[model samples]
Target chain A: MSQVEELKSELTEKLGSDIQIKTEFGDDVLEISKDKVFEATEHFKSTGRYDFLMDVCSVDRQEREKRFDVVYHFYSSKDNRRLRMKAQLGENEKIKSITPIWKGANWFEREAYDMMGIQFEGHPYLKRLLTHHEFVGHPLRKDYDSNRQQHCSKAADLHFEDDETYVPDPNKDLIPLNIGPSHPATHGTLRIMAQLDGETIHRSNVELGFLHRCFEKMAETHEYNQIIPYTDRLNYCSAPMNNVGFCKTVERMLGVEIPPKAQAIRIILCELSRVIDHIVCIGANAVDLGALTSFFYLFNMRERVYSLFEKLCGARLTVSMTRVGGMANNPPEGWFDDVLETVATLRKGVDEIDRMLTNNKIWIERTKGVGGISSEEAIAFGFTGPCLRATGVNLDLRKANPYYGYDQLDFDVPYGTSGDVYDRYLVRIEEMKQSLKIVEQVAKNVPGGDFSIRDKDIVLPEKKDVYGNIEGLMNHFMLVIKGLQPPVGDIYDATEAANGELGFYLVSDGSKRPYRLKVRPPCFAIYQSFTQLINGGLLSDVISILGSLNVIAGELDR
Target chain B: MSTVPTVTRDLHAESEDLLTTAAYTTRFDKLVAWGRKNSLWPLPYGTACCGIELMSVMGPKYDLARFGAEVVRFSPRQSDLLVVAGTITEKMAPVLVHIYEQMLEPKYVLSMGACASSGGFYRAYHVLQGIDKVIPVDVYVPGCPPTPEAVLDGVMLLQKMIESNQPRPWKDNWKGPTQ
Candidate 1:
């Protein structure tokens, strides 16, 4: 039997037979009731089978009897199987919070409650996670007006029930410091409320919705093809990854396999994006640490990669270069030579940075023991990608569940000893070197063929064909005028983004636009543990920790 | 002399009227505008995708230091040119306003990227429709995260406005009959 079938059989034997497990799009989804959510999740944890809670997102079905369907993505580290648990909830009914089992579920549960108004009972600190406190109704619900924006004047006070005032006493030297919504160290809009007692952080709260631009709500209204550009903004550092990740989710729904050349392009661009993303992280982290020369070296290399992207697409930062069926266009002429040369130059830049910061005393002193997290705590917090690997976990989506033929690529996954800021920086450097190798390998052997798939219902006709002949014009009109529609179903797909696992859970109602699209941004889960990571660290360590995390506010809030 | 507008007369008399034998004669307001335009200290209010592009302008390739505006100030009090560099949502609007208000007078605002100019394509809830709803935008650079070149264009345009001493409704300046 398949592992999914084995899981179903095991679940049936352990629990009652009333639970229904069915194969949907090749993965087993266990349909459980509200009363059994906690018990089933506890079983998954206690048995040490599915030890990680990948994501928790809720879908709003306004026309159906069950107003919301809370979906849980559970993964077993030992067996490499993903089990989906779905529980239906009515309009006002509450689902049991899974935070007790998985501490990572705290922010996810709060996000569901804030966006779709789905209540998670017994969830501590269950206030608004994305939208501001002044938001009136749930914006993700179908009935909520998309244009009805609320103006938030005052800042929110996240006060506990039994909390005393923040006023510092004369005896103690404790004080509260607000870090950012506009501070330079935040890189963007992450705000941290840190209570410090003589340079060490005592307690803190993080507010990170300042860059939320309503990406999910916008996707619900746009067609599948139009939504690709919006995905580019999610992880702006790695635009092609978000594009390919979203398009792959839709491609899975359509059941179409892109050409080999297209897969090669996707892999090349994804790895290239990973290299640049890490460059930004390392460069910016060094800048925050007061070592300024490496930033110019790394950013100069980043600009070289940006030039390649400019050649492929027209834009630099937000390159929405992938379509649902395949890529928007092929790489420019002599692209392989350009890519090989760029990767070779990037290696030299990497070496220069290594010499600058690897053994430098100041760099080591600042980042060695700061923000250290154990492997168990990292897994419990749903850390993935480089951050998780920094804690000694070898869980990369590319190795575990390969997509877009990432399995065929020849590269090594870098692991670190302790999950500290230094480990993260080292991991990023090693990963960039691996990514350079992968880019070099793929650029030499790109399969040449059509860039789009064979599905007529999906890919738009070429521009020459559309303007040339009558048959092509009619075909183009049919596809572009009316958008591409998929069958009625929901699918969850993930890609190993530069930051971590970027998952897209898309539900289609057989319409041009998606019924719901939930982007499980890697930054969201990794950034949720900020307070834990920097609880006892010094004030200067906060900047280094935040930089090593590389939390993009767009993806975190969206 | 104030109403004179003949072509040759305007050029000949204008230069002669400003220069004396021993000293240079000019208005103090125009002097301050000249000083402000050439030496614009900028505070980057970067928040989203355009932020990377903003950093690109700060990078070595498209160096903003080529102009006299390379001194990036973190505190609002020290800066004169405010470059609003990304999307301004409703939650961030008040913060944007607070920063703009904190800057002293004679400060100019340059709205970079489409989101800062006209909300871009994010015309949904939680997004403030154009940052002009909260702060006075002097120049609008138009791009979905505009290129560094475009951002520089906006900054140069703000310099021109500052040089010409454009009408400041918020400031008490007298130039016309109504004044």
Candidate 2:
């Protein structure tokens, strides 16, 4: 029997007849009650082998009888499939926190509580994740005004009491250091409060939301097409990846198929974006270790790729390259030539970085055996992409559940045994090489067809047709004035983003705009384990680990 | 004057010979401004995408070192030019303000990118409308994330502003630390 069928039967056996299982928009959903959700999730991790907890988010259906739907996405590497478990509750109702079952659910659950104000019963620290304490309302709720702004005049006074279980010895002397919301090595706006015992980190508390620009709340009001530019800022380093992920989800929901050429082109751009993302991560990590030359070398190559992107599109960093049905524009003539040239040059950069940092004693000493996590711990913390692979767990979404014809593309998934800072760096370097391979393969064999879907409902008409043809003009007006009117439904789709699995949960209300849109940003999962990963390590190793993880503040706080 | 003490007094006494010219008549403020304009120690207040563009400008391609504003200090205490590059959410607003306040006198705030200048398209609950709402801005480079060339232009404009002896109206903040 299939995993879904087996899950249904098994869940029925565990929770009695109180559970409901059905497939919606390509996802096998198991609807369980609040009282039994803890049990169901326990079964998911243990018996069902749904080892990876991809995302946990709450949906505020302002008009629905249940009012709120707490969603949990689980992926089992053993089964190589995803299952969505949801529990519907009232406005004031509290659901079971899965933190005890899956430790990675800590931040995801806190995010649910913060955004939608859905209380989790047993969550250890039920504080806000992506907003300050002074923020008045749950910003993701339908009633929350988009224009409402809350100013935090001072720093939040929050203390994470030792969970009522472990009281610290009052006599132990330790020093506290606040690293960033803006400091050099912290990269972006992530803040970690670390208590040090002579340079060794004793305890740490991560504070995010300093860069949260309300991406989810903004998407609810924006049209299907308008949300494209917003997604660009999600993972600004790999802007096209976010665009593709969002567009692919909407296209899948719209039930439209992009042309072969668009699919192939999407793959090329996304792979190129992945390459750039890895380059930035590795370069930044190397800089933390005082290897500055590799950063310069890698970034020079990054500029070449950015210039190529500028030639394809008009922008550099925030390239909103993809659209709902297909791409915004076709790859210009001789673009593949540019791609090939850049790819050829980028490989040398890869080699240069390899030569510089791969076997260097200082680099090895600084990174190896530092911030290492076992494969089991990594999985329990819901790690994905290269970070998960570095733990010796083979789970690349591109390989396991291929999208945009990733299955046809030939490339190997590189993995490391010790899941340390060094392994992450190595995995990222190898992934960049593999990405270059994919880029070369796809750029060589350019597919020929319409660059976008032929559907008039989603794709805009040609400029010539808009100018000359009456029907085309009207069609253009309708599309531009009133955006895509998708059928009323909700779907959860995830793509393997550079950091991990970037998932988007969308609910359409038969309007041009989405009723609700929740982004399951990848780093949001990996970065939550900061305290767990860096607790016993020295202060210096923290920067190394953070850089390797690349907890992009854009996605982390968004 | 008190900070410099006898250094400026002795320089004034020996102005003719010390400056390597005997007949030169230049105002002290102008000379100070000229010196400040060339070697602008910029503290990059980078928080988002525009920060990446800021890095690009500082990198080898469109090197910021060409204009002599390349000493990118992370500490506010050490910098004169505060290049606020990226979006400043309300949560990040206090931090931005704190960083701005932490900067010494004659510090210039160059609001970089559309988001930093005016919140770009992210006009939502959490985002601060523009950083100018919190800190005084000397230059505003506009783009979702401005191109490297545009960022370079903004820096050059600030240098020009410095050279022309524009009043540092934000200088009023130097009277006493707000905190």
Candidate 3:
């Protein structure tokens, strides 16, 4: 039986007549009544079809009749399918939590509680996950005004609760180690309170919002073309991929067919970015392993990649280059030649890095068996990318879904048998080589054309042409200021990011700005499984696992 | 211009007589020069992807070792140059300010990216817009990363700025501009 269908059938058998099952794009969706959600979740898990509670997040349905709908995304590792169980829980109502079934759902559920104001009943510890403990209101709700500066009552009092005078556990003597609002290793402004049992971590909780740029809200406020710049901040490592992800999501929502040349260019750029992301991961892992020399070696390779990025786009990091249809600017003269040269240079460096660490005794000893996780545990905790591949799960969305002519490209899906840190490292290295292969294929197969979809409705006419023609001028004006509007629809499109399945769920309400924009960031899924991976491991192993995961705070908290 | 006991020799003889000028004034000038030269351990505070490029600045090709800045300390106490190498968000502002405050006197900062210098195009409510608001910037190395060459230039510029100082006057004249 196919994974999707099997999950649906199993869900139907479990829920019986109480739930309404719907399949959206091969995902088995179960719309359980608000009252029966907890019961249904329990039954679904008992059925063994959806053993893992992948993620529990709530979406604000302010415009719709259903005020607030909570989405509980489930995955069956055995079947390799996903099942989403959503409930139309009324505004300000308490719903039963599924934290009992899966311990991993603790953080996800708490995040929903903290952000969406959805109270998860029966949660062991329902404290705010991302936002401060004294934060005034739910920030993620559509109606919530993010502009309000006085969200927290006081700097000391960062979170709030229904209890008038709430006091945390006094007996749990956990020394406060303020990781960062600016400290290194936390990456960005992420501060985690690690309740440690000496060197071992009893429990750790993340305190995000230090770098919360309100990107989604801004994207909603800005025009379509204006929002592309914002995507650059989400996955700062691979700005091109984020741009492509956003554009592709909007394109899917609008049902616009981009030119073959544009598609080909995007694939090439995205794959290059994937390679860069892996290089960073590998370099960072090497740094954590005390192999500081390898960092410089890999950076030498990255310098060449940056040159290509500069040649292709004006900016290096904030590459707001890829537009909705074509590109913001044309490639510089001999850009392809420069790209080919860069690849050649970087390829040699990659080989050297591989030689330095591939069989090195110290590197293997540090990473070989450290932070080993099984495929089942990984899937249960919703791990993806090289992290998932390390566990021998052949699930790269690029191959499975084949967006942007990915199916046409001849590349290998590199998987490692051992789900250890070493395997993850090996997978990322191999993935980089495969990315090179894809880049080479794309360079060879790149079609020549206008580089954009020649359409007045979708893509703005040239500035000169627009000035010459009245209609073109009007269209350009509209596109520049108000942005292009797509019909009302919702679509979820995922690409194989270096980290994992980087999915962007975009909803257009026949307006220039997206009505709803939810980034299914790969880092969040991988980072959630962090505590699980690091539970019994040594203190130093935390650094190892974090590096291996490549959990960028920018993408995670976004 | 009358023979006034030749003030230089008179002062020297008088000082020499008075316990040999009470020893040395810690050789203030040389001490300052030595302190400045030996301990330039920088806090390479990087955020976003530009941080990766910032890391490249300390790497082999453009080794920061020549300037005695190879030891990129993560802590503020031991660091001299705080290289803000990405967008500074409002959420990160206070922390940046705190880190700047924690560093000992005679410190420098390098806003090492378009985002860190001028907010790039990520001008949003959460982003501080620029690092200038949070800390006094010594050099603004402009690029998405300000290439290793640009970083070296900024470092050299900062060193020159530090070197051209006339001690007391430099200390007194240092108004510490907001930028």
Candidate 4:
């Protein structure tokens, strides 16, 4: 039987005849009772339906009797099914941690504890992961003060009380290595404290928030269109994906359909972003592996992409051009022709790089079997994007759940079986080629229409209209001052980002800004599985696995 | 009769030197100019997205080698110019200062982008605000991400700045538009 059906049958049997159990909004979710949650998860894992514990984040429902709801997203690699298990937990109640089933859940559970104040009773190590050793009050709770800076700083005061249960490391042989807040290979500002037994990682604890800007809080204050600029900073390498993801989520919430031309433009920009993102990863990875020459060759191509970006948007990295309903500006005339030229140049450049590294003895040796993880393990650990693709999962959200007209396009979902650093590299390289193909198709199929949605409530009026007409001026002023107010509801929309499934879950309470904005960053999921990839491997292998995963700190910490 | 070609070559070289001397200055000055022009390995203090574009400058496309500024040594110890690309944060100030201090004498700084030039829109509490506060700048390439062509132009400007120092007639001419 299929995983979803089997899950449904099991859930129905548990809930009984009166209680309703149904999948909502076509997402891979199965609603279950708060009491039977632990039992269901254990059954789900043993059934071999879902092995990976993708994310376990919570949302606050102030009005409900149970003020907090923990959302657990699980994935079954064998069936290619995603099961979201949500259980409403009262503020006083605690859930049993699933760390026993999946080792990767250790950090995720701690993060939930740190962010949402949700305690996991049986968690192995439930200490603060992102915040300091002595933090209090979850920052993500609904009633948590938005203006209170004390919550962030005061959280450091809560001490990790050591009693009889917490015995110090009995064997003091392992050396402690702090990877960085300043180290070169940590990517951004992530400091990984690892206990090592002579070049082999005994246990790795990832410390985040050194670079955290409180993006969710910032998004709450900013208007919908204004939020686009901030998204660029989140995953700066793949800026367009952030733009498209934010726009798509807002579009879904507003129930507005964009012009075909705008969709095509979004596709082209997203593909360009994907290509450049891979270029950055490949170049940085090559440099980390001691091949500095390839770094220059690859980054040179990324510069050309940057030029194209400049021509399209006034700003390059922070190209905050998307409106709630559609694009802020249409592509200039002859834009497609220029994109074609750049694509040709990039294709040749990519080939040159492939020639340099495809058979290079050092590269192959360093990356081939290094940081290898099986498909089952990857899925169990909630690996996504090229990292998941490396494990032979033909599950690109662009293909499996086709958003932004991806269903209409014909392209291959390239995958790998080995799930090693080398396989991840191959998957990204092939994915870039596929993205190029998609861009070509988009350029060919772009149609002519209004770029922005005509709905005045969601989008600002045209510049000409605002300048000439009083009514238009007032509308523009309102939009600039107070953002669009969507209906009071929650919407979660995702896109296949260059990294993985970059999902945005926005909760609206009839306000100009989001009541609660949660970004399901794929990097965070991939980062949770880092210790797994590096445990038995060499110290140098950490660089390879970290690069292969392409863990951008902005996305991970945010 | 045996050294006729050598004598002519000497005469040709002497006459060319005389012409160059009449038009300009001493041979010692000319040698200094030559030394400065041939070796300008720019140490790029690239921080943000513009750093990507700066990489392109060294890439095969623009090939900064055509103008003798190709060797981009990351170490400030071995380099001449600090190409400060992207936004420099306040926290990065000490490190950038240390790098600038490490660079050899007669170094130049190229603040590449709006953020580095002035503080782009990220003019918040933490940004270094402007690179000029930390180090003396030679040329500022103004753009959110200045195009590779603009970067090349900045390199040429640096060369001109160096060339004008050699006691030349053009140095007395109008100093070009303030970039």
Best by DockQ: 2
Model 4 regions more than 4 Å off: A1-9, A15-33, A48-52, A62-66, A74-84, A132-137, A141-176, A194-205, B1-179
lDDT of 3 by residue, A1-558 (tens): 865556556656765665566765445677778887877777766667566565667778887777787877765545456667778977768888877777667777877887778888999878765554445777667766655433232223222223324345547755434455566566655565554567876555556666566676677677887888778778877878999988887777666778888888888788889888888888988886789889888877776777788777756666777778777656767777777777777778878989999999999988999888888777767777889899998888788667778888899998998799999999888888888888887877668877887667778888787879898889888777766887775556667777887777666778887877777778787777776676646667777877888887778766
Candidate 2 per-residue lDDT, tens place, A1-558, comes to 976777777878888996678887888888888788898888877774787888888888889988998888888787577788888989988888889889999988888889889999889889787888788779888898998888788765433446323334547757767788788888758888877898898888888898999898889988988999999998888999999999989988988888889998888888899999998888888877788878778889889999999998989989988888888878888999999999999999898888888999999999999888899888888888889899898888899888878898899999999999899889988999999999999999988988888677898898889999998999999898888988888888889999889999988889999988989888888887788889988899898989889888898888
Q: Find the 10 residues in a row with the least total lDDT in model 4 chain A.
A: A151-160
Instruction: Note the residue pairs that clash in candidate 2.
Output: none
Ranking by DockQ: 2, 1, 3, 4
lDDT of 4 by residue, A418-466 (tens): 9999998988888888888888888876888888777778888998999
DockQ class, candidate 3: acceptable
Looking at model 3, residue A99 earns an lDDT score of 77
Instruction: State what share of the real interface contacts each candidate retains.
Output: 0.71, 0.82, 0.37, 0.10
Residue-wise lDDT of candidate 1 within A314-419, one digit each (tens)? 8998999999899888778898899999999999989899899999999999999889899999989999999999999998889888877778888899989899
TM-score for every candidate vs. truth? 0.94, 0.94, 0.85, 0.78
Which pairs of residues collide in candidate 3? A133-A159, A134-A158, A134-A159, A134-A160, A135-A158, A135-A159, A135-A160, B137-B179
- A-chain TM-score per prediction? 0.97, 0.97, 0.89, 0.90
Please identify model 3 stretches exceeding 4 Å from their true place: A1-30, A42-55, A63-66, A73-85, A150-184, A188-206, A467-471, B1-39, B60-68, B89-94, B114-157, B166-179
Which candidate, 1 or 4, would have the higher DockQ against the true structure? 1
Error of 3 at A261 (Å): 1.3
Which parts of model 1 are misplaced by more than 4 Å? A157-173, B1-27, B170-179
Residue-pair clashes per prediction, in order, are 0, 0, 8, 7
Q: Give DockQ: model 2.
A: 0.58
lDDT of each: 0.86, 0.85, 0.73, 0.74
- The all-Cα superposition gives candidate 1 an RMSD in Å to the true structure of 4.7
